[model samples]
Target chain A: MTARRLPSGDFDVEQLTPGVRRPIKLRPWLIFAGVVVVAFFGLIFSRVSLDRSGFELDDLEEQIAIEEARRGDLRVEVARLQDPNRINAIAAEIGLVYPTVRIEIEVPGLDVEGIDPEFRWAQLKAVLTAQP
Target chain B: MVLGVAFVVAWAGIGFRIVRVQGFEADKHAERGEQQRVRTEALTAPRGTIYDRDGVELAVSIDAVTVTANPSHMEDPAAAARLLAPLVGVPKSVLKERFTKPDSQFAYIARRLESAQAQEIRDMVEETEMAGVYFTSEPKRIYPAGDLASQVIGFVRDDDMAGLEGLEWKYDEALAGTPGQQIVERDPYGNPIPQGEFVVDPAQPGADIILTIDREISSAAQQILAQAVKDYNALAGTVLVMDILTGEVLAMVNAPTFDPNDRSDANPEAYRNRAVTDVYEPGSTLKVVTLAAALEEGVVTPSSILKVPGTLEVGDKEYTDVGRTKAKKMSVAEIVAKSSNVGTILIQDLLGNEKHYEYLSAFGLGQVASGDLPGEASGRLENVRDWCDTTCGPSTAIGYRVDVTPLQMASVFSAIANDGVLVEPHVVREVISADGTRQRYEPTERPVVSEETARVMRVLLQGVVESGTGSRALVDLYTVGGKTGTTEKFVPGEGYSEEDRIASFIGIAPIDEPRIVVAIVLDSPSGETEDGSDMRFGGVSAAPVFAAIAEAALHRLGVPPNVR
Candidate 1:
């Protein structure tokens, strides 16, 4: 690079290479504003989700309570229906009476001693099935 | 300069106040705010259910509502009382007086109303735009079987559901569960706040109990006993049917029983389980013990003959056999069949007091026969040392100078039926916890006699039912055996009444394969039977009851007829 003097008695220089450009720098306050805006929206979204879940949970709990109450009523109804006195009264109204005598019929090939009645019945059933 | 200094001092004072509040009193203020929103509530645990052997609900608990009123908020106390009178089953005057009480903020309109009734009242109040009335849910105990086994199952208090009688009082602790608590946040309108403080400790339900009672057999026994009480013109009666093998009580009935559902006019006297609570001199029924002791001690055999006089005098008390006036030679079996008091006293002479007391104690006298029942009498058996050698032994052998509950007598018969093993009787079959852990009842057993001796005693007892005093206790198509007991009614603060008598019969059915022991006790039976038989006698009054109950129970139990 070489320099030349001007007529105004100041030192004059001549540039031989091209001029270079510098990079731009960002502002700190603007970056901070952007971060605050994003955080505010995220907080709102989370709170909305939490409230919706709470309402759903409340509805489910209420429904369970109602169903439990209905189940309890049904159980009570079942118990009342099985009342012995009521059944006896109904039977009497329907002209039903206990038999004075109970007759037991003996089946052939089924009279084994020391065997359970259920087992004997099963054996009789098998014999009848085989005959058919 | 003075104005600047004043402003500086004022700022300094304000700054000091701010620091004091934010630093020192912050926790106190925060706690105060929380107190306004957070609430602690009690959660009640449900009471256990009582089921029969067949899993039938005998006593149950259901959610019911209680109605309350803030009388101060009533606009027209008279109109409100009139509107609620019929609905609440309370008199209008009573309700009005309660509503008009000065400065009264709260009053119970009715407690433990059924759900349907509460709903009706709620609808009426809403339609009429009536104020001051509110309803809260609570538990109410109900008996589904009505008066089937009221004396055995008992009843609970109306307000707190606490047990007051019978098995309810015996197993109250296991049936009432632990309560729990919850801390929650709420808004001003009593609505729960979302995302707020929530903590809960869930309640544990009470353990359920399954009893050994059979509903069908109990119903049959109750009907039979009630009819006997009415037919004989008796004051009261009790019948017990027990499974000798398992020592499980199949039926326990008390006549004049009240329904636990509606006890507003119930007689408190009828609330007692007389089978276990009341004691009486066992009369001729106790002769089996003397005979059993003689047989077990090898003092006599069933064929041994004794010369019995018409009457015997000892310690100024004369003992005589009923319907016998001449001295005769009778075998041991014949004496039991005849229920001869003189013959039994002679047998007691053979077996001394020490041996007799040993057999009585071995047969579960002088102690509670079963721990399952509440208020069960141990029966009066004087110590051998206390027995005055003169009349004590003779009176005791003739069914005097001793007291025994019907349950104890039944247990005595059960021992014979169970092959001489005195199994402890129990009503509770099992207890199932809320978590499904089961604790089953295991009865304790002790041998009272050898199997052969028990068999011989059973045969001798059979002679009584076949043609002897207990002939009326014979069941059709089933061989049965029992002893008749008739005692003069002894009144406290008064001597024995000649007019009143206590008749009882304890029997075992299908004697060859003994399954059940039925005990019947009739108190103060009067009026003879249609055939002119004395109603005050055990053979006439209580034996027939035993027959009816035994037949029904045996049929229900599916015990095939063992006799042609």
Candidate 2:
């Protein structure tokens, strides 16, 4: 310890102590705490990602199921509309009667053209083009 | 020193146990843990859809639900049974009996409930906090066309979705797809653990089928058959419309039919696809085959003259004409037009027994049509060597001793319509797999007769519809060629009955360029019309049905009318 003089002859003391030397020791508790914090956040991150993916998978599954059900419903509706008796009744209601007059157009080799393999492409083209 | 020794002994014991548990017993404990966390479930695949030629839905499989339960998980079995009985449409007593055994692990509450109905039950269960009830997705068959082609399309088994009849049964292997499996981790409440190991194997859906039937034509055919059955007061009826060129069965309908969707009330007899499954004597329709054979062999021409008689003696039995007219000189064409029994017998004698049998066999008689339909009968044909009856030759010629399905009879006429080619008749045209691969079937063709002979027979048949027995079969804007058949139904162990008659007609349209063949058969049709007029003859009863069906079918098929 050393003492220094202040103004007016009053002594202000200054103490000088010798530096003490100590050995470095490893603290397992601090390491453990750090590891636990990192692990907790990692687990949270993974759980959030997993939950998001799972929800997406569930949504896609629900969508597929809904689509399949809709397709079944549409098919049934289409068939109902195509019913012949219903169409016939509708036609009758609209005053469309069956034709009574007979007409035949005589074209030479007409039957052969329908059966010929070489002419099939032309017929198919005509049919496709005829569709509205 | 003694305390130290005791402590060391205890330490050794502890270390040994740690080694034993960590090394030797690890696999067993790990397996036990996995079993608790892992579950295996079956993935349900959807059944196939069936469509008509024009992409009309005929049969489809819709989403459904099946209710199942684990009895051990049920909090109150008695209460559960009471709650579920009415919802599942089962008897309360039966449900209570099922719940009596506590040891029972699982029970089925209901199967194949509609989606809306199942959803209501599920919501109720959840709201009531029911513990044991569970639902599984299933598929139920729906025939949107109802009884339109019921016998042809058939129905599937409720539990396994297996086909039981008709084309469904025949093509079951091609229709049913492979099932899949999945392994997933679930919690105690059966909810999937999102973070746990989850593996999935997706199910593969079944193939779709496209049929050769035209819905419009088929519905029209069904309408005609039903009306014929009602008008004639017939017990039942069958009709078939075939595309001559492709040998595609455009329409096949049967009266006394049942809807496959509501099979609980369907009659067993109504399940038969009578066109290919039932056999009857074809009567005068067989005469066309006989005439074709005779003409092909040059034994008779269209103008070949024959001395016709009212009755022809065959063995001890007499084959008499229906009209009992005096014997007159008539051409072979007149014989077919008049449907004279004695004239047909004369024509058959020219071909003799062996040639006639061979021709009949060649025309697809006495053979299975090999259609993709279950329970098709190979109509009865006695061998030439088994001709024990002295009247077999003449009787078979006039369609009495032999039996033929309407399908076979139609094919015979279709052969002539198809320019002498006898193509195999089929209903299924294409099969589309789940993977979008398509397989189309080609019709098997066989030369039944020469083209020249077929044309000549077509001309002769045209006479029958023009001014003869089948005049009623003529359409308004189209020419028709056909044969009228009226046969006495044969009784078991007895001869042909006089009261019960089968009136039938098979007609080809647009005679110059044939496109469709319509065949109609009315079983035991009454002898009176709605106007109280006598209408027992095929020319009167069956011909008009054929006319109406063929007319509509031709119009729907887009075949232009041919008239000269």
Candidate 3:
């Protein structure tokens, strides 16, 4: 083995051995600061993803609500058609009568002036035959 | 120095490999990312609506709430199932099985709930504290009038609210609108992105459909039909009302109908719309068509007399009249009143086999009615051109060797009653979409006979109502023109069963001014008067149904009784 000279003028291979010593000094505050930065980034990423997901869910729920409301309206219309009164009213329009009408007639201007000449004309033989 | 050189080479190799991987397979990784995100969602298209001729709502689709679940998120599937069991009436085991499946994300829990029931279910779902439980909106078909013209309106199915039968099925394409889809991108939280470029292609709502049925007449026909069915104690019964003036079907009904709202476990055949679907021997009602041909050809006139017999033999087959003696001479009016089998045969001869069949074809027989239903029968005709020799010629007369639907019979009679105008039978009146765009079904009038012939036929038919077998059909306030039919039921092995019979009647009221024409059928009655509707014989069994419907419908339609 060849002898290696170190910066401190030591010729010992054991002191400079691999995995034995880490000479660089590390400050505890600096380590803490680095860890906080990573954690904050991770938390922000997670919150943004959740917010986006939440907004989508709200929109889907809104669409479902609109559809459900429309379905309810259709059910209501069906119920209306089933109503006995409604059916009866419609029936009346088609000419079905409980007391079935035989017929109804209206004659206008029946009070016209008519000659009562039958009584007088029969005795007088009415008018003479007209000459040319 | 040697080790440092070796380390430098290793570092260069590693750097070169990283560059190759990033550059060469870049597109491959991007494709995988897209595969994981893209999804195709199902777009539900709304089925069409069925309307009465007068624009009354008959069948329509409404949005409805359905309970849905994401099985992966169910915390306590068994517990949730137990709580939901009573209200939904679904087995707890079934629900548990679905929720436990990891791959099954969505499952239908309950379907098309009523508003109050849906609200209650929503409350229960919230109370369950399950993670994946949710609600979905789907289209549910609704029939506004319960049991009104049900056979004509038909019903739909589960899974998809597709029309399974009736006009709902016929106009399905027009009513079923286009469906569009929305693909959603969500994070691990199962939330969809709001503006995820919606990729939205707008869905089109189904077109509206309108029918030509008058609500007033429909209800009246149903009322009369129900009574006759009950009184007869028959297996099944139907009454169809149509406008003679315009071939529009006013009301089409069949009793003992299953409601469309809850249509599970119904008989496959019960769902069969008998008005257009079932065909049977029409008996003597066909005499008019044969007689019309004969009279129109100038082969016979109203004053013409026929020597009727009790039984006449055309071939080896012998036809018996309604017990009228053979060689009994009578006017055409008397022939109809007596319903002589021999007279109809003679009339069929005069009209000739060709002319007689021509008249039948002209009345829309052997042709599927172009209604909304696909299964409508063309009734039964041998195709005159295809007719074989032997007794098949005149045997086709008097409603034998032939078949007809109750609807066909109604339309046929409607022509005679409506001043010779033949109208196509239609069910829907109009269709309206969600945004209120509407489409209407209008009546089509076809002249099948001369007005003189129709008028003369009316007088002859009135005789059948006054003195013939249809005597039981006379309404209190108006004269009725009608005909009775009692055809032997066709049996599989024995050919014709003597014990089983089909009694039917078709009629129109106020003969002086015709309006409605109705046909009623009682399939195999018990001859029992146990019920309020059935009475066996056509007049006894079916005519009363006509009276009830006509009474109510006329009153509703504002048709005045003949008087003053």
For TM-score, the strongest prediction is 1
Off by over 4 Å in 1: A1-56, A101-132, B1-29, B68-110, B119-135
On lDDT, the stronger of 1 and 2 is 1
Q: What docking tier does model 2 reach? A: acceptable
TM-score of candidate 1's A chain against the true A chain: 0.54
User: Mind giving the per-residue lDDT tens digits that candidate 3 earns over B1-564?
Assistant: 999989998998998877776678768876775556655676787666565655456676766778888777877777877877787888988987877776888888888875567778777777755577777677777777766766677777766766678766776666778887867665455555544434766677777777776665766666666666666667887777776776667777777676676666556566667888889988888888777777777878888987776777766888887555557888888878777777888787777778878888887877765465557888888888887565777677788888888888888888888877778776655667757876665656677788888888888888998898787777766777888887888876888876777888888867789888878888876565544533556766776666666666666667777733
Steric clash count of candidate 3: 47
List the TM values for chain B, per candidate.
Answer: 0.91, 0.89, 0.85
lDDT of 1 at B25: 87
Q: Residue B558 lDDT in model 2?
A: 92
For residues B1-564, what per-residue lDDT tens digits would candidate 2 score against the true structure? 999999999998998888887779888888887899898988767777888998887888887678888888888888988888888899888877776676987788888776667767878898889888887668888888888888999888987889898877887776777777889887876767776778879888889999998888888899888988998888899999999999999999999899888889889999999998889999999998899999989999999999988777778988888765688888999999989899999999889889999999999999987567678889988898887547888898999878899999999999999889999998999999999999997888999889999898888888999988998898887988999999998878998887988899998888899999999999988767666645677888999999999999998889876764
lDDT of each residue in A66-102, candidate 3, tens digit only: 6667555755576565655476777789987665453
Per residue, candidate 1 scores C-alpha lDDT tens digits across A1-69 of 487755663543333225754445567767978889888888898898898888788878756654555
Per residue, candidate 1 scores C-alpha lDDT tens digits across B1-564 of 999999999999998888877788889878987999999998778889999999988888887778999999889999999999999999999999999999998899998777667778989999999989987678888888889889999988977778899988898888878888899998864567889999999888888999999999998899889999999999999999999999999999999899999999999998999999999999999988999989999999999999999989888988888898899999999999999999999999999999999999899898999988999999899999999979999989967878999999999999999889988899999999999999999999999988888899899989999989999999999999999999999998898997999999999998989999999999999987888999999999999999999999999999989897
Q: After superposition, how far is residue B549 of candidate 1 from its true place, in Å?
A: 0.5
Number of the predicted model whose DockQ against the real structure is largest: 2
**Best model number under lDDT:** 1
